[model samples]
Target: MTMKTSFAFALAGLALVVLALAPLVLPDYWTGVLLGMTGYVTLATAWALFSGPTRYVSLATVAFFGVGAYTVAVLNEVMPYPLVLLCAAGIGMTMALLVGLSTLRLAGVYFVIFTFGLAELVRQTVSWWEVNVTYTMGRYVFLPFEGRHIYWQLLVLAAVTLLISWAIGRSRIGLALKALGDDETVAAHAGVDVTRIKLLLFVISATIITLVGAIQAPRWTYIEPSIVFNPTVSFMTLIMALLGGAMRLWGPLVGAVPLFLLFEWLSVSFPDHFSIILGLLFILIVFVMPNGVLAKFDDLRKGNRA
Candidate 1:
């Protein structure tokens, strides 16, 4: 097998081995941390699939995520849990369709800003629903769930997200998206249907995120604007993708693990300055190693010329 293929297998094997042994080896607290980290890794990977390949960074990546979480959160009051998940995916796709069509008309930074604003608008609308819930509002939304159910559901969500990302990376649409990313004008001229391709990716990516959000809702058993619309999601996803090396399919995992460990440490040891330090590290990464920490593994392995 080729060296890259070997490396991929080795990495996968190593990850599997660690995961298999971890529960038996680690403490309960640490297990929880790892589980949460796994969820974050899944999110990073999902964002990377669209942004990395397309080079069209969508800052509103969490919009669909929020849509999914809220759909289940509100619906769980009436619908079954499984149906909530399906509805979450549907909500994400619907949001993607609307946002993609509206913002796809814009170019470059404009598209990013438009989507960001669109996400903000969605957040505000959700907030408005609270008024209806309390008194002026006509409806109320609440979700009742246990913590463990959410945790195991997240595991399944992560697996599904990973599988979809892998399939997309190897699929015809993925190739088209990659091409459109490399040269939009040329791809469009070539009859590649650039808008449709991006829209499809938007929907698929959103669907995955929504599934994750649905899983999240049960654990938190609550949903709110700031958390759902947090800019941190964009930043964290960016950091993970950058660390893992955007071009490589496995880069998000490579990036998120170390960063997340550091986050856990800082949060535990120096809670006060954690955010500042994390922010600085991101700047440092951008200024020093723009390609990402993990994507450069191959470079580090190269020897001097004879």
Candidate 2:
């Protein structure tokens, strides 16, 4: 409606068009890099959708992600690819619903610890099932999709996620979430249906994350619990979301791109020290830009205007 809003939407649309055509023009190596970047963009954005508003700080990203990948690995042989994705979403939503109902009541560090533990629990469970029942440590994924296809799918997912996040930010539920973030007691007193709001957003976030994992599974070709359900995925997503200013719709995108590039470089240049550097970066972000780069920038802009 407003000129600024119309201009922003136009710019976003142009960026999306350019990104969608990226695979055709980009070299193989760069395309691969872009694919990975897009994966994180989707993950971080989805993570922020729930965590940013409610300030829940969930670490269960990999649980749902691994479930999605594993779902594809197990059922791709028997079911259609689209059906497998749907199943992954369904499983993710169910898991999130159960977990949210039980743990959303817990706040601060307790919620954080439980979510981290939940990912580990899912990983261990999958590992046990493979070892005892399947008699295999990992499953191979055989699909017709290539890196470009996966990249496109992730790109689309990321776009949809951004759109959904933006839409939610403009809705009544978004206000409820923000109020919940500020003070759960006050929000409930104000008739916000706190539990329902948190659970709904959490499930939506988890389902998107699951779909991301399913879309990306074929790229791995071989997925084990450890590989698919790596804890680093959870941490990286959290760091990115926080770094970008999780409270803002486009904050995760800002954080994910730069941090993903930094991680890529660190992984290659200092493979042994990569984890240490990641930990250090996380500490630095928490101390230096706890409200995220976007918030910091906004603060400076306001100060200048004043």
lDDT of 1 by residue, 1-306 (tens): 679978986886676666756667677776678677877887888887777777777777667677776776577768877787888887788878887888775785877787667668888788887666533422234545444445556666666667678778778887887788789998888889888877777777777777777677655544666776776666777787787777677788888888888888888999899778879988988886677765466667775221
Show where candidate 1 strays beyond 4 Å. Answer: 1-26, 133-148, 302-306
Give Cα distance to truth, residue 296, candidate 2, Å. 0.7
Report every candidate's CA lDDT.
0.73, 0.92
After TM-score superposition, what is the CA distance of residue 60 in candidate 2 from its true location, in Å? 1.2
Model 2 accuracy (lDDT, Cα): 0.92
- Model 2's TM-score against the true structure: 0.97
How close to the true structure is residue 84 of candidate 2, measured as C-alpha lDDT?
89
Q: Determine which window of 10 residues in candidate 1 has minimal summed lDDT.
A: 134-143
After superposing candidate 2 on the true structure, give the runs of residues whose Cα lies further than 4 Å from its correct spot: 304-306
CA displacement after TM-score superposition, residue 2 of candidate 2 (Å): 2.8
**Candidate 2's residue-wise lDDT over 103-218, tens digit each?**
88776678788897998899999999989998999889999997899999999999999999999998999888888889999999999998899889999999999999999999
